[model samples]
Target chain A: MTTFVDIQDVTHVYARAEDGAPAVQNLNLTVREDEFAAIVGPSGCGKSTLMKLATGLQFPREGTVIVGGREVGAPVKLAGMAFQNPTMLPWRTTLDNILLPLEIVEPHRSRLRKHKAEYVAKAECLLAQVGLKGQGHKFPWQLSGGMQQRASLCRALIHEPKLLMLDEPFGALDTFTREELWCVMRDLHAAQKVTIILVTHDLREAAFLADRIFCMSARPGRIVAEREVEFPRPRDLEITYSAPFASLVQELRGHIAQARAAA
Target chain B: MTTKRHLHLAPWIFTLGFFLAWEIICRVLKVSTFVLPAPSTIAQAIWEYRNQLAFHAMHTLWMTLAGFGIAVAFGLLLGMALGASRLINAGTYPLLVGFNSIPKVAVVPILVFWFGVGWVPPVMTAFLISFFPIVVNVATGIATVEPEMEDVLRALGASKRDIVFKVGVPRAMPYFFGSLKVAITLAYVGSVIGEQNASNVGIGNLLTRASAAFEVPLVWAALVVLAVLGVVMYVITALIERSMTGWAQRSDMAAA
Candidate 1:
């Protein structure tokens, strides 16, 4: 498979000392096209910094980041992001919040005024896909935490970006809600076949959603290990309880433990 | 007097009771009309001079509004500039605070000196006094934009202007509205300060005119009208805030 993203020995430093440590040091990672990849590490492992670098939110102090045949000199126009917090604009209704990116990204942004109804329909469909059908009139505060997250997903996917970056989008949810979202994400990934890079701290979550996992070392983080999950498509939540899945999780846990020790 | 049927009327009931107590106290102490007129006396003054009061009140209202309107427009632009640029914000925030700290009333004389004892002094004073809160509030709202939200917008190749208009300005709405309420009230104070000394018109001038002539009941009457005007403007602002920034308030009000 052709490499969709190639990061070469990236390093980044914050100008503000109060922001704490330099985020990344000699970090290198690669993911092929159509790959469902997850990055897992302990807290403060610079996983967030990695996300920033990949998405072009930060220019690397050293090394290069290539995504979809372009250098990440600026934030890529063809990427969508959903963070841990829903971060829904409180002023906008659920549908309007989902429609926000369309009003920003070009081609879509230019055409939005002329094709308002069509875009609205697309947003409604995406919202419905995440189980928020007919709830678009409600504001962010009106929805529960789980419901807000689902809307967040819809907003991220609204423009149909080629690259989807999720930074623990389900981290705030309860176990049941988290599992439900994992299933939703799995189906979404399968259907869209767009490359996804999920940055999470949970190994089990990584195993469930990702086809490949990148384990990171803490404090000025770099990828320490890369492993592939040979799970069949359309895997149910039941698979997480299986012996094979347990062994897989245990294996990733060991890599994470070693990375933590090495740090 | 009962709380059950007319619970909404309790504030009015207490207000009437307060006026009755004041009248009784004035009668019991045999106070002169020049010292402290009773509510009944003020009411009589209001009736006798209704037309003059209305005219002056309108003058004060519009002058305050004109100054306040300028403040709102200028403050928003200045606040946006301060919020969007780290250099500007860092340089000006402390300076603005220091400027705001100088008692606004002190500047009224300077304004009068510059503009020469007319509507300009009050209008300029109101603008000067009222704009700070809006600047601070709008700047704060823009500066504190959530990092994740910025990332989301920036990832889509959004320029600084795009991110600001799409996220920063909309995010700043509640803050902008909050500052408007505070600014409008302060504008009234500024106008009154101007009218008290330099201007020949407005309710503030009327207060000066009546008090100087020792028409105490008329002074009391002007004060009542001023209070009513303040309440009316305040209610209008609160209503605008409710309609515009409902999302910010929904969590608290929803349960009620």
Candidate 2:
């Protein structure tokens, strides 16, 4: 597969960079087209900064971020993002919330009013795919945390975004819900064939979903190792109990622990 | 069912009980009307001066609403400006607080000097006094938009205007309506102050006249009317808030 997102020797400094440390220094990473990539690292490892740079929410002080083969100077219109918090607008129903990006990103923005019925149908289809069928009419607060996250995922995919950026989207959910969402995400990747960049602290989550995992060092983060999961498609929760999965998780944990000690 | 019914009737029962206690105290103490007219005497005075009371009350209502209308428009615009930019909010906030701190009653004389003894002073007072709460509340509502929420839209290459209208404005509705309830009550106080000093009509002017004439019961009746007006305006604002921001209300609060 062709490389869709490429970052080269990127260095980013937050305006209020605490302790005079850049958020991410010499951050080099790439994800191929339609690939499931996960970045796992120690706390304050600048994984979020990398996500922001890749999505063009923030510019790197030095080096380049290219998505879809173009240098990113502004927020990439083709990217859809979700965070730890679902951040659903309380005022809008689930369906409307899912349709929010369409109202902003064009050609949908221009055609939204004229073809709202079509868009609504599309949103309902996505909702059903995420196991939130027939719950579109309710406000977001009416749903449970896991349900809200499901709605959030549907929202991220509704505009048919080419790139999906998920920042610990399931971190707030319970363990069972998290595992369920992992399955949901696995199926979504298989069906949609969309590029995904997941930033998470959970090693099991990374090993379970990502085709390739990038491990980063603590403070002023930079990728220290990359491992490919040779597991076949249609990964199941049962594989998590296998010795290979535990060893992969242990190895990733060691990298993080060493990175933390170096700090 | 009975608990729910009691909850429904609680406000009435408490209000009537308060008045009954005041009436008993007044009668048992043989308190002079000038000191504290009984609720019964105030009710009698309200009946006796019903026509005059209605005219003044209407005048006051008009003045308060007019000032409140202006405040809402100006406050919303200014609040948007302040809320949209941190620099603007910081630079203007201290000035706003200082201006609000200067008792609006003191400004009534200044207003009277500029506009002279009429509706203008009362209207200006109400506007000045009421706009602060609205500005603060609306600005707070907009400023509180979660960074993650903005990122959801911003990541889609949404414009600043899109972010404001989609997230900021709708989020601020609850705060705006909440401030309206507060602003309306402040507007009444402002109008009354202006009327007591400058205006020829309104309940405040009537209040001053009745007190000067030693019609203590009439003065008490005017105050009652003002309290009732304040409560009615508050309820109306709350109803509007419920309709507009039902999503923001918790289940218990919405049910209530």
Candidate 3:
């Protein structure tokens, strides 16, 4: 498959940060079209910075970030994003929250009022896919954390963007819920065939969901290792219990430990 | 259930008990009408001069509402402008603070000078005193849009206008409504101050004339009327707030 996203030796520094240290330096990575890519690293290792760069929320200080074969100068309208916090607008119901992107990103923006029924139906379908079928009428506060996260996922995919950027989207969820979402995510990737870049600290989560995992080094983050999971499609949660899965997780954990120690 | 029912009745019971205590204290101490009129004396005065009191009360109410309406429009516009741009907020914030710090009562005379002794002074005073809170609250609401939430929109290539309308304005509704309660009350104080110093009508004017004539009960009656008006406006603003921004209030607070 052709590369859908390519970051070439990127470096970025936060303008207001007191110490003036670059958040990420020499950060080289690439993801193929429709590939599920997970980035694993130690804390403050610029995983979030990389996500920002890829989405064009922040420009790289010294490198090129190309998404869908075009250099990202402004926010890439073809990308959708979600973070650890669901951050749903409290006033809007789950259905409306999921439809928020359409109100901003067009041709939907221009057509939303006229085609709202069609859009609402699509949102309901997404909710059902994520195991939240009838809960769309409820507000964000009324929903549990897991349910909100599910709604958040539905929202990210609602615009049907080519690239989906997730920054530790399941970081705050409990273990059972987190694992349950891993299956949801697996099915979403299979069904949608959208390119997903998941930045996460959870080694097991990374190993379970991603087809290829890129492990990064400590401060001024750069890729230290890349491994491909040879597991077949339609992954089961039960496979996570196998010895091979544990060893893969252990290997990723060791890389993170080394990255942390080196800093 | 019993405790909840008691909580519901608490405000009315307390208010009645408070007036009862005042009436008892006045009767027991035989306080002079000039010194401190009894509740009964005030009530009698309210009945005796009901027409004059009603006229002045209506004047005060209209003046306060007119000024408050203007403040709402101007403050909302200014607040949105301030909230949307960091440059505008930084440029005007210090000046706003300095202006707000100056006693609005002190500005009434200047308003009177410019507009003459009439409705203009009272309306201007009400607008001046009440607008700061709305501006501050609305700006806070817009400025505090969670960075993560903003990222979701920005990633969609949403415009600055989209960010403001979609996230900023809605997020600021609770704050804006909250400020209305404060601004409405402040508007009353402002109009009353203006009425006392510059205008020939309103409760404030009635107060000045009655006190000068030693009609102490009439002064007390006017104060009671002002209090009732203030409470009515407050309740109205609060009800509107509840209807508009019920989403922001937690269930516990909403119950209260």
Candidate 4:
């Protein structure tokens, strides 16, 4: 498998002080095309910092962070991101929020005026995928928390980006909604074939959604363990209760506990 | 006519009650009309000069609207510009504060000197007073957007123009309307003061003339006209605000 996202020993330090505490020190990771990977770690472990580096929202102080074989400078137009909060613009409706990327980024930007109806149809389709088909005209505040996150996911995927980065996207959701979103996301990846990098604290979430999980240490986050889930595809919520699933989650939890102690 | 009697005649009940008591006291004490005209005499004066008062009231209304329109335009453009530009914000912020601090009424004489004894002085006075609330409100609104919201746009590679027009403007609408509601009332007061300082045919000028000539009844009538004008402007602004922020209001309604 080809490595689509390659981070070559990246180090990120905040410029304000010399506390000798970097956000991420000598971090290296590569995500292959069509891979579903999760990074889980102790609190304040800079998992989100790694996501930022991968998406080109922030540049590493030293070394190269490349996505799709190109050095990340400004944010990549071909990448999509969803934060823990939906961060939906209150002014726009669900349909407009989903169509935001298309309106802002190219080759969709120039084509938006000419292909508005087609793009609207595309947004509607994505909304339907996330179980918000007819609620496109509703504002973000009108929807529930789970629905807003779903709409935000649609916004991220609207432009058909190659890489999707989720930073604790389901952290704010209820347990049932979170599990349901896991299936929604699983199906999305299955259909889209986009590389997904999820940064989460929930061991169960990592075990359930990701094919592989990378566990990291606190503060200056570094990979402490890597585990692969050989579970079958189209994972239902029922799979989380199986013996193998429980073992994997517990094993990852143990690694996190040790990492926290060491920190 | 019955509804009118019930509604319009309601205020006079108290006024008539006070006057009847006053007339009884004044007749007993023998107080002069120059000091406190009897309610019957004031009513007679208003009935006789109703046409003249209406003409002056129309002039004041036109001046108020003109000044208000200018203030809204100036406030929105200046607010958006200062809100958008950090350098401009830094440079003009102190100046705006200084201008706002100076009692706009103190500048009425200067406005009169510059624009002469016509409608210009009152219009400018009203603009000076009314424009600041709108500018401050709009500037604050534009500045208060959620950082996370802007981040999403930034991460998506949205240009500054796109971010502002698509995001900032819509988000700032509620604040602008909020300010405008307050501003419109100020505009009316400012314009009236402006007209009072120097104008040929307006309620303010008539007020000045009435006071100078000791026509206390006409002065009261002009005050009543001013109050009516202010209420009308306020109602129009409220309607506009309701329409502009319909989405937000609907959300609040739903939450309720």
**How does each model score on lDDT?**
0.90, 0.93, 0.94, 0.86
Expressed as tens digits, the lDDT of each residue in A1-263 for candidate 3 is 89999999998999987899999988899999999999999998989999989999999999899999999999999888988999999999999999999999989999999999999999999999999999999999999999999999999999999999999999999999999999999988999979999999999999999989999998888999999998888889999999999999999989989999999
Model 3: lDDT to the true structure? 0.94
- Candidate 2 per-residue lDDT, tens place, B112-174, comes to 789999999999999999999999988999888899988889989998889888999999999
For all candidates, what are the clash counts? 0, 0, 0, 0
Could you tell me how far off, in angstroms, the CA of residue A64 lies in candidate 2 after the best superposition?
Answer: 0.9
Residue A17, candidate 4: alpha-carbon lDDT: 38
In the range A1-263, model 2's lDDT, one tens digit per residue, is: 89999999999889886677798889889999999999999989998898889889999999999999999999999999988999999999999999999999989999999999999999998888889999999999999999999999999999898999999999999999999999999988999979999999999999999999999999889999999998898888999999999999999999999999999
- DockQ of every candidate structure: 0.88, 0.89, 0.94, 0.44
Highest-scoring model, DockQ? 3
Q: Tens digit of lDDT per residue, candidate 1, span B1-256?
A: 4645476677789889999999999999998888888888999999999999999999899889999999999999999998899999999888888999988779988887888998998898889999999998999899899989999999998888987888898889899999999999999998888888889999999999998898888898998998889889988998998888877885634424
lDDT of 4: 0.86
Q: Give the TM-score of candidate 3.
A: 0.98
Query: In model 3, where do residues sit more than 4 Å from their true spots?
Result: none
Q: Which is the better candidate, 1 or 2, if ranked by DockQ?
A: 2
lDDT score at residue A90, model 1, on the 0-100 scale = 89
Model 2 Cα shift for residue B99 (angstroms): 0.9
